[model samples]
Target: MAPGITTVLDVRTPAARRQLAKTTVDLFRNLLLLLFIVRYSRVALTYLYGYGPIASAKMGYAALRKSLYRIFLSLPGVRGKVQAEIKQTLEELEKKLVPSGPGITRYTALPASGWGPEQVRAELEKLHEMKHTRWEDGRVSGAVYHGGKELQDLQMEAFGRFGVANPIHPDVFPGVRKMEAEVVAMVLGMFNAPADAAGVSTSGGSESIIMAVLSAREKARIERRVTKPEIILPETAHTAFRKAAAYFKITVHYVPCPGPTYKASLSHVSRLINSNTILLVGSAPNFPHGIIDDIPGLSRLALRRNIPLHVDCCLGSFLVPFLERAGYDTEPFDFRVKGVTSISCDTHKYGFAPKGNSTLLYRSAALRKYQYFISPDWSGGVYASPGIAGSRPGALIAGCWASMMSVGEAGYITSCHQIVGAAKKMAEGLRSRDTLRNDLRILGKPLVSVVAFTSDTLDIYNIADAMSGKGWHLNALQSPAAIHVAVTLPIVPVVDELLNDLEACVEEEREKQRQAVVEGKPKAKKGDAAALYGVAGALPDKTIVEDLAAGFLDCLYKA
Candidate 1:
């Protein structure tokens, strides 16, 4: 035996060495096979458990459809037609979004010398005067939440006071720091948060939601050692949650919010929960249909499963909290509900705060700590941030604080009464009006400011186009082919106008369909909204839509 040979195994003979090598190779192969089976088995089981057999089958069918659609798109003629259509659509989008004229000067490059303040103001006035959606007159839905001229003036004054303030350096801007803390505290109190609850202001609703999702992910990783975290979201939950999951490298299990309630399915959410699930999400009056999920039921599930629940009240904002006080129906969705670890609310929407102001509330300070990013070792020295942003604009914080202070509880209750009252009235008109009822039907029972409706006899997108022709900007929805009017303060007095316009659009679309049939045509020509949504609905794979959307974003930056 050699000096390094083991006494337990004699490998002096060629036959012995060959047998040992074969045994070692076989052992490794078996291990690899076992690992492959274990990994795939877990994946298969997760799918079967998260989505039931029917839903899993549907998912498989959708994947197959996507593949087939991609193959079809790859064909020479089909590819050419698709590319041509997309190019045409993108051109139309650019024309609509990017204004261009002989008189319009493109500011593509900075001037050699900065212009005077008066010159810049004149240019801004010119920009503001350009043709655009007249949201001030209340035709638009949920874009601007005006709090009267007085409130606007006050917000402007506050902004001027803190023009260059940044909340990152609290010592330098103590007043802004105080205002930020008070704003969070006030909002937490509005949401019925406990004494131990904590919150941080963020740039907007999207950032607030992202922070909440990040907090849950961090909490799960630190406490439960969950390497592969997952989240269960209602189908109608804000898209920011999906964006957050994508950013954080977490898996998302979207439970369907099926009609007619258009709320998350508690049963499906329950089934989706596993040891790896980090958080559960519910929307308070989701954006599309304005239907609140069953939060109490979701809370119970969250408690039983020992997972955190985050209620997205960004759209709900000040209105949901004041609903009962305003003498309107409401649902349970706040920190008061057990197992709800976090909530996101936008002061900009119904709170009448300026843009770029939102808050994320945690059930306790410990939970909120997870969202904080602190670095102890850095060349620049130790640094910490409460949320995603590093140096936040204190002017927006001041504006938010001023807006909230100017609009006291009584004021919010009154606004809530007016807004929700108008929404319910619109919903009632849509349901009871003979012409509107004949063609259109409201989706879900909307208790919030958004009233969504779809038509069974006519194309809803066509009706949206007709509404646009009448200067009413309504939000178009998919999956059910619907349109929604998010009733704001501006829209309160115009509720009757909205109902009348919607009725006329429905009738007009019906007449067009009738005329098309009389002319021996398959259907009428598609309008802008009809054409865009038609293309979107027809595609099984949304790569084309994605490209068009990217093009639209590009148009936004075009001079």
Candidate 2:
């Protein structure tokens, strides 16, 4: 007990001092041992799990699962049985896709001689007959927007009038140029853009998105002298942005969407921004869940940071801009927001136009000009094109213009009402179910035409398959797994049918699961979608998924 220690230790008690000393030493030794083990284990596991036998085992498991499925189909009598079933299914699908047989009207090669007008008309009729899925009946979603016979007739007449027109040469096709300009002007006005706002028509939504990205990248390079550029977007943004990143060599920083809301987390987005970030993207109503992001906040952030903000209104299209005017509740997400530099809207989607039409607008003409491709030193004279494609189809442009003109402002307002009204009704019906209400939940407060739902107590993919069996094609989503339906004019007419089918499918699945439990049978493993998505979610090395995706694409082209 020196001056510092005093009687605190009670050193006089030899047994107590001995026990305390031993305890202190043991605790220190254990702490050091834990640190050493943790440090070494990380390094060992990195190498062990990264390659060699352990990695090989995981691959083997995946291959075995795939092979087992194949083997099940290959069993002697089973092979014939399964092949017959598959053949029948394929035949049915082909019948649906193409209703006419080869004898009906063949166009295998170019005609030795051009057909006359009446012959062309007859050939067109036969081609039309071969189509099934009457999208005009509203059987399809987000396709064939305006199905009125009057509009179709008008579009057909307009197309015939300008069938040979090309906007590539303004001198030769002044009318085509004027129509394209007017279409862009109308869209700009619809979005509440300033007089200075300008745009160019594109082939479709993907081109519009790509053009916007290209403009942003060029602006960053020229204005900020940024050689290496990057863009920040929500994970919910369209895959087109990923394509843009790959094509333009721009790095993409993806921020996670917030839970329940399914919108981009503003805080995380702000945190990810750096000097290299040239563009920030927010979707007016993202496709998967149809949840609009906090565009105003994103715009303000862009304004404060002096970065470009792009709002993707592609899926939302005409529907979003007119939501408020149509007497529906919606958040502000357009050029009216101070920081929005550009927007992409699909004239083909809710705009009620034919396919292959979209508009990419900018805050100023200078911004739009950057999207143009020009080669002044070309040997074949100066070359220029406003978008990716040259010699564009004038008939498609004519059809788009006619649709817009016929629908006008009031028509769009009315369409929005019907579509959104139907969607809300469906959402309400789903929300009222006890089993589905408790186990399944909507992804967000969907204010648009799409409603997505996922289940906590069942495999949503199974429900998707069930819906498919009922002859309804709903989109299947992953990464927390859900399914969504984009309500359209056709869906509006048959929403009650959809809801009834959903209820029956859910009940049937619940009962099947209950029986499996009672009979002591192992629950059925995940179906095709779950197995595919499960592999995608579990793989940390993304290259494996890339290979899988590539293989899937290759399968599509196979005979």
Candidate 3:
């Protein structure tokens, strides 16, 4: 044989080689196309099933309509009118909010000359004397959970002790570190989390929720290779979850909490589950109606699909955990449920702690590790921080710890008894009174401290305004046009007063409706609540509402 002869066994002829090369190229090209289809198909499927097949189309249409409406309203005359209305509303808000009269002065900035300590103290006392909602008189809802003199003193003392301490430097503040740990441990114990369960402290319920969502998304990405994460929650779930979705780039599937029980629909949640689902959410006595969700149902569903479940007990907080102890019947909402993976509870609410305190608990340390941010290669000595903050207020943590310890378990049970007892009484008044029941319909069977009611026959917002007129503050909700009052220890003594005010407000609204009917005209009365909600609810567009909200925040910063 020749030195470089080509044979049949060594290689095919040049024509055969050309044919093989074309076949290989064609095979590679087809593989890439198939990969593209597979990747995009998963994304399409995630959204399609996350929202119902028809819901996706409807949402798309609504979004388009809203966008068009926004553009239309942005025209010169229209925009000017809208801005003028917002400005007027803000002016009215400022008048209602800030102190007034000849002696009152707003300290918009520091005095040009530094004041002596006594001068500062005198100035503070004058500001405190200014007109404000008398929360101490028990007319306000949800804001001041427990305002007892002793508890307030204890929190103030705790804050004084740790005012300068920062948890970011735990070594520098050992006592704060211990207190924060104890606070989390006690909360976890209350939830009946397993031995391996763990948690981290947060500034508030919103941060707790955000951390839980972040952990779920990260876990799904690392473990299951999911790119587009999705979460399913009840319609009654807190707005905080929606904020979390916006922050984390997660798609949200809202299951309607229909009439009657107003609980999360298990069937809807089941239908929405997909391979990309990062989390499932259930509220323990939701903020709107104060009705606890069917947690056992959601837990079973999550177990079947192997998805993480988060229970938001921010409003329920300290009270829901002690419901049975407080001699009230309860349902499964804590870590006892088999598939429950995480829970976010606010120490600021029913826990009676300082304002900036909450906890996010996880089923295990492994899951919680996902929430930790580590920078092993950082120039500044390898930075690592837990939760969403670098330097957190140790004073708040100390205050929270003091509140929880000072109250103890027995104290919490007693407070829950008073608060829940007051709430149930209010609900009973709405349900039993013939005229009141006929005029107002309770949204759900509230078993916790909140009671929400709607009126299909009259303007509930007007009733809310009337309550405000009587110096009673209530929360306004839309989608069904309702209002709610979250009972606190401060309100426990004034339950009867609340009932009386509610009855009067309802009658007032009913009379207005009746007069409008007799005159053959639509009932039109305006108040801050009425105007804000009525306009927002009537329009398909949210641009005006968004603008007003932004403007409100801006107003808070002005002098």
Best by TM-score: 1
The estimated TM-scores of all candidates read 0.97, 0.79, 0.90
What is the C-alpha lDDT profile of model 3 across 76-151, one tens digit per residue? 9999998898788778877766556686676778789999999989978977776778898998898887748899
lDDT of 1 at 527: 83
The weakest ten consecutive residues by lDDT in model 3 span: 5-14
- TM-score for candidate 3: 0.90
The RMSD (Cα, Å) of candidate 2 is 13.0
Better of 1 and 3 by lDDT: 1
> Model 2 Cα displacement at 158 (Å)?
1.4
Output the better candidate (1/2) by TM-score.
Answer: 1
Model 1 global lDDT (CA atoms, 0 to 1): 0.92
| Model 2 lDDT tens row, 1-559 | 3677655666679988898999999999999999999978754553344334555476567777767756665679976875575455445545444436556554567899998999999878877775455554445555556646788798889889888988898898888888899999999998889889999999999999999999999999999998878888898899899999999999887777867799997876786677778999999899889999999999988999999999999989999999998899999988899899999999988887788899999999999988989999999899999889989988888899999999999999998999999999989988996756866789989999989999888778878877767767778887668988899877888888888888888887787778888888757456555665666676544444564455555544433
Root-mean-square deviation (CA) per prediction: 2.9, 13.0, 4.7
